[model samples]
Target: MSETHALDQIAAWRAAGRKTALATVVQTWGSSPRPAGSHMAINDRNEFVGSVSGGCIEGAVVEAAREVMTSGVPKTLDFGVTNEMAWEVGLACGGKVRVFVEAVE
Candidate 1:
């Protein structure tokens, strides 16, 4: 979904008193799938919208977002072709991505 739509969904979740997190690609090196502004909105239920690293590391971002939702602490995640999980997620593009995930207040 578009960032605007995803952000709207996050707002709706917050309105319903559901915990949520926002993950954004803060930095990237090489041929990262998504650009730095790419975003994802994740709820406490582990459901999410948007993409931070295409399909490559969105799952990881969701898991981290879930953790952030629970702990109320932000996290920075780094994934690259050198990481085995990158290969698992088909991020064979040999790029590196840095994502920041924080709880939605």
Candidate 2:
């Protein structure tokens, strides 16, 4: 989904008093599925929108987003061929990505 649409959805959740977070692709290298500036909106309900890795690593991102929402602390997640979870998350296409996850106030 478009970034605007994702933000809109997250905004609606926030309006309903639900905790929310946004996960953004801040950096990418080599065969990345999604480029920097891509986003995903996640709420305390585990609902989400958009794509950071075109289906790769989204589960991890959502889980991290949940923690960010709870702790009110941002998290930087790195996944690549060298990371063991990269393979598990289907990021094995030989690319590296840095995602910044932050609570949405």
> Total clashing residue pairs per candidate?
0, 0
Error of 2 at 81 (Å): 1.2
Best by TM-score: 2
lDDT of candidate model 2 versus the reference: 0.90
Worst 10 residues of 1 by lDDT: 83-92
lDDT of 1 at 60: 81
**lDDT, candidate 1, at 73:** 87
lDDT of 2 by residue, 43-83 (tens): 99899999899687999999999899999999999998888
| lDDT (tens digit, per residue) of candidate 1 on 1-105 | 467877998999999989999998899999988999888899988888888876878888888888888888899988987776755654668889889999988
What lDDT, from 0 to 1, does candidate 1 have? 0.85
lDDT of 1 at 27: 97
What is the clash tally of candidate 2? 0
TM-score of each: 0.89, 0.94
